[model samples]
Structure formats: structure tokens, C-alpha cells
Target: MNQVIELIQSHRSIRKYKDTPLTNEQVETIIQSAQMASSSNHMQAYSVIGVTDPNVKKRLAILAGNQVYVERCPLFLVWCADLHRLKVACSLQDTEMVAGTTENFIVATVDTALAAQNAAIAAESMGLGIVYIGGIRNNPKEVAKLLHLPELVYPVFGMCVGMPDHDPGQRPRLPLELIYHENRYDPEKAKKGIEEYDQMMRRYYLNRTHHSRDTTWSKEMAAIMRQPNRKHLRSFLEGQGFRLE
Candidate 1:
């Protein structure tokens, strides 16, 4: 296999990191790789804040469901979907930029995610470990305030980067047959594979972690979806000047 292909296959999220800090050159290389990602319409509508302040990282870790990795990691980056730049450009031209719509918001978010993923892959190639902190969305309002994000911009997610203290076992993914369908679709075939994959997940958890119960993937999915986990997002997006209508 190609080196990149091997890297892609072996990639695992690393939540526990060593205390060693990254050099400025390493950080710059990661950001440069992130900026190289292709953006929608060439409008690179995103920004990344490299946070090294212990106080700021501490608050962010708390806001993100008390994830200690955020504060422990030597480098913390908050990736944002930024439309404020376009808005400013429009203002200078004496024209209005109506990017609070759902389409615009989605585009910016996709752009941000692509860039972040590129950065992750690039860092992994450099023998560094990284993990994405989606829990940052748990308190988007507080995260925005902490990062000083302007209107039309929001924190999509966070990344913790550093050397790995321990390499976690590979987390199982769904069988490719279930996820990759032919031209039309095959729901029945996919459903059968899901059961096997759920068992694989259960075994992985039982062997690796303290999770003793045979928690099927379906059960976990239902629990999170049925709960009011993101009920705040609708109103929160509105508060951030996004009109998702």
C-alpha cells in the first residue's frame, strides 16, 4: 500500500497525549497543510485559533464536558466556520452579504471540517497524535465567548495535538459492504452487516475498556438520538446570526 493509504488506514483518535510541546515550525507546518485543503468556490471561509494559554485551554476543557485532554495537550486548536471576512468585504463594497442562510452555513462548515481533517492527517504523518473534540459544541456559546468569535463565525470543533502517551487499539468501523452500496441501494443487505458490526464493537469495548455490558451500536445510537443532546443548536445557531430556514 502507498504511505498515505497506510496512514489513512492506521489513523486512530488519540485522547491521551504526552506533555512535550510542539515546536513552532511543526505547528506552522500543520496550519499550512490545513490551508492547502480545497475550499468551496475558493472562499476559504474558516479560521483556526492556536491556543497555548493554559487559562484559556482550561476553560475550554471545562466547557467541552470536562475533557482533560484539551488542557493536557501542548497544542489546542479551535477550528471555526468564518463568514465574518466575507461580510467585511461586502461592507467595504457597500453591498450586503446574505450568508446567514443554511446553504452558506453548511458550505462554511464543510470547508472547516475538510481543512481540519487535512491537518490531522498531516500531523499524523509527522508522528504526532491528534483527537477531535466535538464536545466543544456542548457549550457553543461559552466556547465562542472564550475564543472571541465574531458574528457569522462559530467554532465547529477543536483539535488537541501532541505526542501520544499510549496508542489505543484500533476502534472498529462498520464493514465496507454495509456502507458502500451499488448504483441504486440495498437496505436489506446493509441491515444484516450492521448486526455483525455491532457485535464487533461490543467485543472491542469489552476487551479494551471498562465497559462490561454488550452495548450494541443500535442501542447507543438510539440513546443519543432520542435524548435532547443538541436541542440548543437550533436556537444557538440563530443567536449566532444564522438563519437556517
Candidate 2:
């Protein structure tokens, strides 16, 4: 395949990063790449916070379930879904912006994710490694307070970017049939695909962990689905001025 496709397919989450920090030019290029991502109506309802302060990173690491990578990485970027700027624009025109419909919330969140993925690609292309830290959502309120986020803004996720100290092989994805459909979704196709992928993953995990962790993807997914994850998210979002209505 082409270089771009090869680059994309070879993606891996780099948890262990070297102490080497990114240069100012590298940071600018990555952020500029992120800004070029397509946005819904060009609203661009998002913002990113780049943290280099050791003290702040240490506290963030603790807040994010003690993910040491958060503190260890030279650059930690918090990607936020933001509508506060839109509100300001509305106010400038003497229009009271409708702050938090569910649609608006989805748009902002998707926009943030899109921008972040672009940043990831840019970083990877530049020979840097990155990993997304969803753990930041574990303590959204404290994170928001620490970040000094305003209303109509919430942290969607954080990213750790630096030189990779080690290579963790890429994880296998589910069978294509399970995710991609022709036109109408075929339940039978999905079922068969999952069954096939489970066996593939079973072997993969066993091989990867020296037979210490012999589990299938479906089982892991079932365990995750059984528990209510981050039930506090609703209240936190509401408090952050996202009506979710």
C-alpha cells in the first residue's frame, strides 16, 4: 500500500516514552495539523490544552487513575469539546446562543475527536509516538477545575506524545465483517464474524502474554458491558453546562 496507508495501519499506542521533549516547531506542526480537520458547519467547537508543567502533570497523572505515562510523557494535551467560543460569537451579535442541545453536544465531541485523531496521525508521521488517555474522564470535575475550564466546555480526552522508549506490537482488530456492512446490517454476518474474531483474539492474547492471559475479545467486551462505567459522567456533563437534552 501507499506510505500514508502503511503509516495508519502500523499505528500502536505507545505507553512507554523516552524523556526526550518535542521542539516548539514540532508542537506547532502537530497543532496546526489538528486544526485542519474537518468540522461540522466549520463551527470548530473544540480547544486543546498543552501541559508541560511537571507539577500539573503529576497531579493530572493521579487524577487520571495514576497513569504514570501522563506525568512521564513530555507533552500531555487535553482535548476539549468547547462551545464557549460559539456563545461569545452569538453574544457579539446580540443573540442568545442555545447552549446545550444533544445534537450540539455530539457535534462538539465529534469535532474534538476528529481533531485529536489528526494530531495523532501528524505526530506519528513525524516519528513521534502517542497514546490517548481516556482515564482523564475518571475524575472529570477535578480535571475541569484544575484546567480552569469554562462553561460549555468539557475535556473529552487527553493525549500523551513523545518518543517511544519501547515497542508494544499493534493489537489485532475485529474481523471486517463485524464492523463493515454492505447496505443493511446483517445480524448473522456479525455473529459469525465475532465468533471468528474471538478465536483469533484468544490465540493472540495467549501468544502475546506467554499464555498467561488466555482470554477472548468477546469475553472482555462482555465484562466491560456488565458494569456501569463512569455513571457520574451524566451529572458531570450537566454541571459543565452540557444540557444533553
For candidate 2, list the clashing residue pairs, or say none: none
How much is 24 displaced in model 1, in angstroms? 1.1
lDDT of 2 by residue, 112-148 (tens): 9999999999999999999999999999999999999
For all candidates, the clash counts are: 0, 0
What C-alpha lDDT do the candidate models reach, one value each?
A: 0.91, 0.95
Best by TM-score: 2
lDDT for model 1, please: 0.91
RMSD of 2: 0.8
Best by lDDT: 2
All candidates: CA RMSD in angstroms?
1.3, 0.8
What is the TM-score (0 to 1) of candidate 2?
A: 0.98
Question: What's the alpha carbon RMSD for model 1?
Answer: 1.3
Clashing pairs in 1: none
Per-residue lDDT, model 2, residue 112, is 100
